[model samples]
Target: MWILISFWVIALAAVIATIKYRKPLLLTVPFFAMLGFLVVQIAMVPMPFWETVRFVFSLR
Candidate 1:
């Protein structure tokens, strides 16, 4: 999907910008936050995707 592609492009841009200019908190913080989110998701590897979605949503 184009949306997915664009999302990745934006994420890549953030990473590149962070690398090029290490002084921007706006770019660096979100990049690390997203990376942390992915790490947590990876830790949930044993759960099914639907169950993970349900469990996470149920918390809020």
Candidate 2:
């Protein structure tokens, strides 16, 4: 949950910085964001795949 919050916070900050500086953060930021998500994925290594799938479905 903290990771999710941090993701949004970082994204918001990145967008603001990009707009203020007139840089190409639109292209570069997503790669880094996806890398952050990949790290979160790696951290969930012990959870069973089926459990994760079921939990995803339960959210709906």
List the lowest-lDDT window of 10 residues for candidate 2.
Answer: 22-31
Q: Which residue pairs come into collision in candidate 1?
A: none
- The list of candidate 2 runs beyond 4 A from truth reads 40-60
- Alpha-carbon shift of residue 47 in model 2 (angstroms): 13
lDDT values of the candidates?
0.69, 0.74
Which regions in candidate 1 have their CA more than 4 angstroms from the true location? 28-60
- Which residue pairs show backbone clashes in model 2? none
For residues 2-57, what per-residue lDDT tens digits would candidate 1 score against the true structure? 74576577677877887887756646655665677676775677888777767767
TM-scores of the candidates in the order shown: 0.41, 0.52
Q: Using alpha carbons, what is the TM-score of model 1?
A: 0.41
